[model samples]
Target: MAENASLLVELLTEELPPKALRQLGDAFAQGLVAELRAQGFASPDAPYTAYASPRRLAVLVKEVAAQAPDREIVVKGPSVKAGLDADGRPTPALLGFARKQGVAVEALERMQDGKHEVFAYRRSERGARLAEFLTGALEAALKRLPIPKMMRWGAGDAEFVRPVRGFVALHGEAVVPCSVLGLAAGRSTLGHRFLSTGPIELVRADDYEAVLEREGKVIASFERRLERIKQGLAAAAGDAQIAADEALYTEVTALVEWPAVYEGHFDAGFLEVPQECLMLTMRQNQKYFPLVGRDGRLLNRFLLVSNMQVDDPAEIVHGNERVLRARLSDAKFFYDQDRKQPLQSLVPQLAQVVYHNKLGSQLQRVERIEALASAIAGLLNADRSLAARAARLAKADLLTGMVGEFPELQGIMGQYYARHDGEPETVAAAIEAHYRPRFAGDALPGDAVGDSVALADKLDTLIGIWGIGLAPTGDKDPFALRRAALGVLRILVEHELPLDVVELLQAAHRQFPAGTLAEATVGEVHAFMLDRLRSYLRERGFKADEIEAVLAHQPTRIDDLVPRLEAVQRFRALPEADSLAAANKRIRNILKKAEVVERAPKAELMREAAEQALFDTLLSLGPQIENHMQDRRYTEALSTLAGARNAVDRFFDEVMVMTEDAAVRDNRLALLAALDRLMNRVADISRLAA
Candidate 1:
């Protein structure tokens, strides 16, 4: 057996797509390790380090075997009865099998094959060497990489995300001979395109990362490079805060092998444009981090991550500033050109832009949203006129120059333009906030008018898109109906608004033509929203069964869903909760089997003491539970129902519900039906049963 040692593989290439660099690096490392583990060259849980930079992708896996363990081979031969003649003598068939195995018929072992005995041959086979399998493993890993598109370089048929420049494969101090993408694997690779003097040599697989960083001036690890960039930005910002997201940090890390953060500034005069516009241009176009002062306003200054590190970065700073000035100038041009006209003037132009071919134009959609927003405002007791005006202008900015340049600035530019037009403050704010909670954990609209418009907007999309039979299927939600549904649920439940989901969908449907939608669209969308609600509640840490208990009722007033789920959770902890839940489940089964009509229990039909006592208890608890339910005190109502557990258990234990007397059985079924109503007012407690 060959000794086990760490293995290293690196691929040097042209600059990779910055946005996809992290994913590519992860796929490359995991893919290689997985394939190696599958082939028995590495352990199942082998530790590996992934390295990704602008020009390289590499992985170092620990404790990889030089050769796999030897395997045993077995070949089953003819059955004993077929192999022998009537006198139990060897036949020609058995002799032919023995000749193939290079052994006499007596050397064959007899083994049971199902119900028949068979002759078999077994032998030991040598394990595969690392050098024999490394090339194939490397090729398999590369083929499995998550490269959406592959490009071919030169005249060769070899392809990758970018042109392959070099390759390195090492096991301890030895080079595992292999070839990939027309490149022969060696122990040397280029580092930091312009920083290192020449190709760096790896003496051992374990020293790859350290050697690259020390001699090649390249930080091989993506995470380490990202952290270094973050620390540099923080230190350079000093008093000001850097305006950058995780995505920006990751992209910058991918663009640099040796990251050096430098500060640059644009003319403060460009601050007249909305800070969002400036910040987006700096981050998206120039890959710079915009600085914000303690006052929460954009500063003229920004930070840039450069691949080049030098004693004096004056030219680098000047070059970046000059490029950003051109980009910011374009943003300013769009903003100024857009503000020349009031946002309302752009509404008529929306008719030229098609929202969807199945649906009407953007103008028609905006009108629907206006009417729906007004209706929702009435439901919330907010200013209907303000909501209508906000919705009317919500998509108008989509026709503006600034929005055309930056689609993400649609609602934001609308707010700025609305304010500039001297529109009502509430309406301006609503126009901007109508798109709140755009993604998960995002903030909700700040005011009632915004809430009304936001719900109206999302509900309109959910109904219209789903109405035309374009509902999401199997992760394909091009219309984003799932997102819109989740947004509506979040607003209703989070805001605790007094609106039913079905009612909102109905109102949104009405905003369209009489025959515009399918009749069942409202019910279908409600069910879909309920599914999203289940997942949403689970993410909030509610148990699956508890959520199902409350959702079993399919309550339209989702504002109280959390309270009902909480009540179910609390009820599950009670001493009698299990017994009551089990009894409820049993009672449900009896009623289902009996198929009895629902009615109030008759006092005259009660023949047993336990039955009468359970009846009296239900009557006594009815008003208390009703009052608690009316007050929306779900926990109190469930607690009150818990008091009836003893009576419920005794009734089931003492009385036979399915009796021989038809009248008695009917009466008892009615009694259980009445109890069922009270127990399930808050939630179906039976779902909580073990």
Candidate 2:
């Protein structure tokens, strides 16, 4: 056996979905590396790299040691009571223990420790060969690695994300022996399907990558494939700009075993369609890159990446051209059909389609959005008429032919269709922006109209679902309420728009049909939105509990969240705030101890000057805190909270709050309650870190 042998394996299958393959490649590499380390066979220079293609998934590791380290083994025998004889020497129990440990009674030595006599021995063995151990681990990983969706091919019932056709496993110059899902491992792998048909025998681990490359394939690393794809694309489209979508390029790279760039063209007449439509149609549907002319107009030509390097490139180009023609023709048809009717005509049809089984039809949802949008516009002092118009048509595109075919183009198609129907420009824009910030880090709407509609749409969805008792449970958020809530917060905070989410929810709750969701029982829903807000703040570098404390006291204004969060962050770093929190904790601890035997007092009968002083200070800060919060001066508000800390400490030191006098104790307790209320206004300072 080679002492420092390493292994390389390749699984060549049919074209895999790009997104699926990227995820699969990452998961396979991580799992393999962990399994190698777990078996105690790690080498300093050894690491795994994964490369994916539409036709194959490959993993390579270098300079692996041939054997794991050998180590001493210790075995413990039965207790002294079971092993010792009358003379404290060998007995039947000791003999049985020795036999179990593969050591004879004569080989065993009795050692008397503090409490009992024990028998111990050391055993040593050579580590398993790398080639053998790797084969077992590889097989285990192949079977255990999760694929989002899988298929069962041929017989033997072995399921995989995609069908497995060929597998090549090489350890140095020899093949590794392992079988997975009924397929035996070998050194033979095919390349480029039709372009290269012969079996490529991987004789050496290092030579495997070269073999695939020589056979018109780029199989060694995803980075290499990405680099080649980008360079090839740039070269194909010279001076004329052909901006490659990074997301699309990543997906295209994952979809091919051997990427061959070729140019194709469509009749320039298709460019008459809006640029968004043409681009979405080509890039999203056919995965083709559209070209631009010197003037930045959509050109007649496009670029296509193929897995196969055909002898006749023109034929492949023609085939792709035909497919794109059908797609573009379908898009043109939808565009023309949508233009036949006024965009408003579709608004009535939405009522027939159910938004949810329990929560009325789409028309009802539109009504809720309209009401919610108007309220939001009023709150933000935006163009209420424009917001109402935007909300009415926000979901109108759901009934459009193009959007029905491509659900992702819901709001986008609405904007295009609304524009064609001669609606106001702001309305059309809002129609598109209603779904802003669809994912984290995505852009929110820049216009007030879009912002208002976005708020209304998300709030309506959240309130409607929560009102109906259909709130998200655990991981199953079918309504995407969590995402909707995050989008609302992003639009409000990122745009610095003033929106009272609580009041907006209340207004929306009123618009629901007679039995819409029960408005009163959505505390969990409110809690859910606050949790999302806290998470958003935490992601932006605020501490989790700090965000929670700020959100706990007030979660209505998304605009208020920023300064409050900023204050909490700055306050968290201060030594005085930490000291105050610790001091409050001590006072609460004392109060809790007293509560065990006696009740606390209210504020009216406080005789101690410290108690009265603390109450007066708390009262004085109440209006200041409200004013600071109103002005978004949260640092000032927190400082106002700091003003009462000394008074609280003095009151705790000088006065016994839990006195036997019922009225006096009640009054003292009321003072603490008032203090708690005031402190909570700035933030739950009680929740601050020490």
Candidate 3:
């Protein structure tokens, strides 16, 4: 097999945030592959490599075929009713279909599989060359690929993350000609914004790496950029260690066309503030990387990379320092001002800020949070006073100037203010930890008080939105309800807090119903909680049927649901579990047969040996099944059902269940019915994957 050729693409644009780069990179790669496959490109595999910087998004494909493979197509034509006339002559419909198919009218043939007459035809056509279709299709796909956010430049219609300044498209040495969003296809691409000289001509797809390298651009791969960023930051920090925030590093690497390391310092006095405040202010506000001493204490120094290289390093350092100074000053002012007032003082200010137009004010949300958290604390056996204190101040930061500018600092500032106000350590910790693991892979709440507050906050958000019918509709969950739901699951799972989620919902709803916030009722809120839980658990590696099964048990506590699900999943893995599932299905089938006559066998009249065996097995296993399920030994319960398999198969094999005597038939049916109840305690075996 000869090595397949490659195609290269580069969409040069203005600087983009590091966060947006991956999203755009993914969109382009996925869209290109999907389009090529759709256009019938079938020459081995065309794997893609993508690289992004602040200015350009680039991709290089490998092993793409020179041409598409010829494919056979089966086109379904008009039905016999529409294709045939009374005289059986080729009707206008048949002629029209042939014309639409690009086949001659005489080529039409009637295909028959069985009794039904159907109009079908098979045609083979030579596929268009890969280059030709790829060129056109790639151009079209690039224009339509969805970016999370886009901007219009040049003309109002020209919209992308940024202006489309240049495009590089090549298949082997040949330039694939097409245009998108006003940019014409070319082999020319701009390299690193400042480091590279000018627009460089990509002689061929294979030369992409060499050209960028020679031009002082690091475009071959992301590994090089990541290495340089990591090495440079570490070298600059020396004894002052620069710990990489995985997320922050990724965002910064994507935001720069050519990353150049720079370090700056703020007044040491700022270290007096909490590390969370300084880190948040630095990373969120200035996009500067933070540094720490060997002892893991916050160092007053910070490091950042500039996308552009400056002639004067000292000037660049001074400029960045100025920005840091202003930000740290503002942070200091907010911290000091917040300390002067007690945590209780901010409680009244929350009323002025509306949480949601329909959901009332933040004060009302705090009220809801307080009540729910207090109730949840009681359920979890936490200190109710601490839970209520934490909940009341959770949203107070929304009114803070610091949080207003940096919404990500909501909980961080609350914790700071709580501690500054000399609130109990538990309450302060809860304030900060309540929003733990705000997103996927985020940390779970650390303590009982924190867990309770976390649960209450997410529950309030979920129930409040659900009550108003403003629940996440499809993929449009603007409220991040999905995250809220996941947070609820994480808090429950990590804390292992035995909870009745429904009871919690009822408690929360009772405290903060539509009347409480002009929203809805407890019943409506409960339904929404169920929806959020379904979506949440499904995301956390639970199958839909597994969720349905465990949720059917409706364990009130998240702790109960987790183990029950773990048990169900454990049972699902066993060999006998499948056999038991098969038996249940067979039993249901037997019951179905008796359904039409509306009569079932009775055990009293079951004289057959197999029927007697099945009845005895069910009778013996009934209490064992109940005991295992009561102990939450779903796996054991499923194991117990394994006993019914041979007995069930034997009964089906020898006995005629639908007998003349309704009493005998119903009695046998009752035994099978008992088996279903036991098996279903583990899972609705009928819904298990076959």
Best by TM-score: 1
Q: Write the per-residue lDDT of candidate 1 for residues 1-690, one digit (tens) a residue.
A: 227989999999999998999999999999889988887788898899998988999999999999977878788999999899999988898999999999998888889999999988887888789888888888988999888899999988999999999999998889988899998989888878898999888899999989999999999899999999999999999999998899999889989999999999889999999999999999888899999999999999999999999999999999999999999999999999998999889899999999988778999999999999998899889999999999999999998888888898879999999999999999999999999888899999989999999999999999998998999999899988888988889988888998988888898889888887899999999999999998999999999989988989788999999888888888889998999899889888887888778678899988999999999999999999999999999999999999999899899889988888888889999999999999999999888888
User: On a 0 to 1 TM-score scale, where does candidate 2 land against the true structure?
Assistant: 0.84
Ranking by lDDT: 1, 2, 3
The C-alpha TM-scores of every prediction are: 0.95, 0.84, 0.80
| lDDT assessment of candidate 2 | 0.78
Error of 1 at 449 (Å): 1.1
Sort every candidate by TM-score, greatest first.
1, 2, 3
Q: Which of 1 and 2 is ahead in TM-score?
A: 1
Q: Write the residue-wise lDDT of candidate 3 on 447-561 in tens digits.
A: 8889889999988887777766666777898888777777776677666777877677677677654364434445565565567778777877999888887777544566666
Superposition error at 504 for model 3 (Å): 1.8
lDDT values, one for every candidate = 0.91, 0.78, 0.76
What residue runs in model 1 are displaced by over 4 Å at the alpha carbon? 74-121
Each model's backbone clash number: 0, 13, 19
lDDT of 1 at 349: 92
